[model samples]
Target: MTDQDAGPGPGRTPRLPPRWFVRSAWVVHRGYYRVTGGRRGLWRPQPDKWGTLLLRTTGRRSGQEHAVIVAYFEDGANLVTLAMNGWAAPEPAWWLNLRAEPDAAVVMRDGPRDVRAREAEGEERERHWATFRQLGTDVDGFSVRRPHTAVVVLEPR
Candidate 1:
């Protein structure tokens, strides 16, 4: 379980890839979007699957724009995603920025959207997490590796 998940027997979680590999992948993914002028990077969320979306947030300290590709799904008019950081220990920078300034933007297959970010709480959090499980995301398994993770909800603003 990558020396993280706590369990009696063998952990169900798979060993995560190396940190350098994960970071490199993120850079490449963003590069692909820019190189293609976003013609090929954005994707739509499916009922039974998560989809890719480019989330843009303002830097908390620098006040500059930062973007990241994250997996998300529709929850009615809102979009929901996990701050997974590729299953790494550190929180994703995009999520950190959202925490600082809730207002953000996203580009999906449909078009761009302005959104306000907030943490899903209590029942809401459980419901969305359940949806992730149902979609075969193995969220619980992956989350065992982190001390805490945020279930972020992006409401249209």
Candidate 2:
């Protein structure tokens, strides 16, 4: 677990880190992961609660491969994540890429696998959100600050 998640109970919403801090850390994090060949930075979570996965998606406009380390939790055999851009107002690029092309790849501790992404809706969204809440996350609090907070499910192909 990281320091960000070490303090108080999950019910207390932690302040979002500064954008500059997050961007700076992301640069270092990507560099470390590239240098370690997936041996390091493979299980990083922001709050250090949920598991991590390396999600690769095709850039919607660039048509280039883009990989991002994302926090995720397993729901049955599927992986669930939020399309929250560091809690920023803008939507995440990976989620946009997935919307353009649902087919993607994810690297987990087990290994890499092809997967299909879909936004959970209605009952499914509620179910997943409830599960996150049960994990002690203040999902509604953070989600309310943004226009869109998609609940994404990645299913193995």
Candidate 3:
């Protein structure tokens, strides 16, 4: 199997706890958002409002669409998200699904739109990293821990 297929190992186990935390927070936030009609503004405490966006990507194996909310940073006309938390691991499930099917949909606070997912590299990655660092203050120590991060840009279709 390739390195990606090998999945997480012993050294990566600690990262799992953080992933669980993020997932639980997402669940609670979504529930709160539904309860408040998206007015609570308790989802993400960041500058830019950085509110959660629901991304729908096709399942790699099941060929069905799966939707999940994630924190995102905007760049001009593109929407960017990082694979830093367990959700953003080198072999994250959503990232893998996007790889299999780049076309997806994103529902932000504004509205929903069809988008194409692409992994950012070189200068684009650097630019988004800076933006994320500027907007994400709650994620303390994220920069130190996830220095080598992958940026995924979603362009509207």
Tell me, by TM-score, which candidate is best: 1
Candidate 1 lands at a TM-score of: 0.91
For model 3, the local distance difference test gives: 0.70
After superposition, candidate 1 runs with Cα above 4 Å error? 1-10
lDDT of each: 0.88, 0.83, 0.70
Worst 10 residues of 3 by lDDT: 7-16
Model 1, range 49-156, lDDT digits (tens) per residue?
889999999999999999999989999999999998988778888889999999999999889999999999999999999998888787877787777889999999
- Which of the two, 2 or 3, has more TM-score? 2
Better of 1 and 3 by lDDT: 1
Q: Supply every candidate's count of residue pairs whose N, Cα or C atoms clash at under 3 angstroms.
A: 0, 0, 1
Task: Show where candidate 3 strays beyond 4 Å.
Answer: 1-19, 33-49, 86-90, 138-140, 143-148
Q: CA RMSD for every model?
A: 2.5, 5.4, 7.2
The list of candidate 2 runs beyond 4 A from truth reads 1-14, 44-48
* Two-way lDDT contest, 2 vs 3, winner: 2
The residue pairs that clash in candidate 1, if any, are none
